[model samples]
Target: MDLPIETTRLRLTELTLTDLADYENLIMIPEISVGAGFNLVSNPKMLGAVARRQVTAPNSFGIRVKGRLVGAILLHEQVGFDYQPDHANLELSYFLHPDWWHQGIMSEALIKLIEELTASKTIKTLNAEVFSSNQASKGVLKKAGFQKKTTLIDPLVSKEKVIYQRALR
Candidate 1:
């Protein structure tokens, strides 16, 4: 619960309840939500609920730029995922505000996170399932040393999700 990963231009820390408004504003952008999954929140009440859920999620982190929450990154243990037999799996996912896209903020944050998490010895393999249409996410992952393993159709999202993985140990 005390995870905090930092880079030159961004900080990844636990999402707090106080970040609801900023988180909502970032996530409600339709373009941002599409690649990250889900639709924009339609009302303030729904936004509040969504924010609460994120804040309470076990390993979710808010990405800060100049002291403001502009995005999020999460690493979650996969329970029933069809993982490789030799390693436990952790799924990595991230999204940045459209305004910050193309600036390499996410790439920096994620590269640093992988270093920190790998050094901690708490993760065996870091995996990602990105929407096939999301070339930016794919590029970020590949740049951070993840290798494409397969492509599977995700029934929940009704799209092809490309599976990528990197060994931590």
Candidate 2:
């Protein structure tokens, strides 16, 4: 996949350390943090450490609008899922600032990302697990062609989650 994939209203770029402050502000929002299963971190150092890991992760992109970071999208190896790590399977996760919600920003970003990854021909399936209550996220996934694969209680979070998957191959 390429860096800085752009859509009409947004830019998907490699997330960098420079985006730390904006990232912090984004995750500090209760709806975002709690919905994404992130514990609110009051310690700056801890937050920085977490941010560092996210920014450096492969396939992580900062969702920017007018040059301001407002959210992030990331694809990584499936962890607790049954899928094998064959490089063709990945888990998708993302969060957007509440202020940007309901405006189709996340759906646009996700659709573009799906197109790019599918064109790359290196990914076969993209999986996303959202808390059952996150209707907005489910809507975004559905808009991007993901279908609900299953519903189960996530052991890590102890919450009912809906698993969505998009096949590229």
Candidate 3:
């Protein structure tokens, strides 16, 4: 709903070309890349292209700490769910640099984003699917008021995933 939402220790802003280098570095980390369903990119040009697309992608935000890019959050159309045609729903996906893990920074950023999106009244629901093995992400979602809706094997990644959902209204 708004660009550059701020929390106590982080800034959530629209991704830009200027963030390309940091984005590339963060996205290349194996733990983050693989966990987020991204194929490892070795070619610099292809990496740059992906970074550029992320910059231009709608509802994508760069998670910055102290003016440095450390993570990202993306909201897109939610699939595999049935709902009234008029209801607006989106799926959430996020990844953070390993150095920032377990710091509660992600929970903080996610809470703020949820607040802004709910306040805008444009979103009726939000959903996130986390690998069942990713307890940290599950904790983050639970802390942000999401509830487990279902569990299934994610075809794209072939991993068991737990779907969490939060209703705004």
Winner on TM-score between 2 and 3 is: 2
* lDDT, candidate 1, 67-100, per-residue tens: 9888888777777545543235678878899889
Which residue window of length 10 is worst by lDDT in model 2? Answer: 78-87
Name the 10 consecutive residues with the lowest summed lDDT in model 3. Answer: 78-87
TM-score of 3: 0.88
Clashing pairs in 2: none
Weakest 10 consecutive residues of candidate 1 by summed lDDT: 80-89
What tens-digit string does per-residue lDDT give for candidate 3 at 10-127?
9999987788778888877899878875665667788778778877788889999999899999887755445434337888899999999999999999999999998999888998
Task: Please report how far candidate 2 places residue 24 from its true position, in Å.
Answer: 1.9
Tens digits of per-residue lDDT for model 2, 142-167: 99999999999988778899999999
Best candidate, TM-score: 2
Per-model tally of clashing residue pairs = 0, 0, 0
| Colliding pairs, model 1 | none
